[model samples]
Target: MGRRSDHSPDELRELLVLSGHALMGERGFAKFSAREAARRAGYSVGTIYNVFGGLDSYLIAINSRTFRQWGAWLEAALIDAPSDRAGRIEALVRAYFGFAQNNQNVWMAIYDHRIDRSIEIASEDDAAREGLTSIVDREVASTLGLNDNDARRLVRSLIATVHGHCALWLTGSYALLEEKDPAGQAVDRVLEILTHHLTPSES
Candidate 1:
């Protein structure tokens, strides 16, 4: 036989998402195309429609997958954090860097304004944001005893810091720093700053 060919519709959809992510990472959203995504995913144009309804829907599905992966990684990392406040904050910071390193492309896509423009065409963007908000609310805020507003603010700050750090790292601005474990030290310092802000006494 040529191959086993065991892929189901769900499996094929997942593959399409993976392929779309790869293309977006390599050439970005403006340059990515449905035909290219289908080719890379080992599917036909018709199959892409069957799985996602259309090109815009397919891109939304891909973006949703990226958010889902991010949420899962965050949840797993938080679950293993120490119960103490400081320890939990440190774990969260480390988890941020860990996710950046492991999913640099997807992370870039998540924050890239170029890709954000695609949100106008699909409803999945809102779903992805909701999923992310849930993680931030439960794992980051609830663990630290903050109210919903504080949690959202703190999480936004943390995300902003990580995004700046990751963007610089990706653009080679941290080449010298990278020579000495830049990401680790950067994450530690971020955790220190955030923890100080989140301290009960500071409230």
Candidate 2:
């Protein structure tokens, strides 16, 4: 017979994930440990393994949850944003910067951790990852009136541009700029440049 656990498997997994998330939020990916998570959860190390298989799996779970939570936050922030194409796009970009700043450790961890290829993806996990992409796609499609293919391409470019600006801002690349919010100014400048390329029909 299998060893009995005080908490059900599902409950134990959630507890482990929650604890792991707290640890990562404090120390980020570099310092997070399954042992610490187990301690936080008041479960034995063996129990964490039983719940999540290993630390990598637990980390992946945390990353997955992070994506879902981030997506929801972005969605809520966009709700009250202006419906005009340019306004909405700018809002989305600003929201991205805020999210990155507020959750620097957790947000970065999404890209910091590398998952094994052999690990099977759950449907919800895939959906969580796609949620952010879909938001951008929807906005791009509506704003540019482009087909799905073109909108996807544009979304990818827009995301790259936003990420580049944010990354540069994080590295203090815009420190000397005259603008009060260098990152915001960078975002506006990049958007202006990209918008300039749009022909009448494309917009």
Tens digit of per-residue lDDT, candidate 2, span 165-197: 776665456543343575577568757855755
What are the per-residue Cα lDDT tens digits for candidate 1 across 71-113? Answer: 7887899888999766766676677667777776666666553
- Model 1 — which ten-residue stretch has the worst lDDT? 1-10
The local lDDT score (0 to 100) that residue 79 gets in candidate 2 is: 97
Count backbone overlaps in model 1: 0
Per the 3 Å backbone cut-off, how many clashing residue pairs does candidate 2 have?
0
Candidate 2, superposed: residue stretches over 4 Å from native: 1-5, 171-182, 193-203
Clashing pairs in model 1, backbone N/Cα/C closer than 3 A: none
Each candidate structure's TM-score, on Cα atoms with residue i matched to residue i, is: 0.69, 0.84
Task: Give Cα distance to truth, residue 5, candidate 1, Å.
Answer: 15
Alpha carbon lDDT of each predicted model: 0.69, 0.76
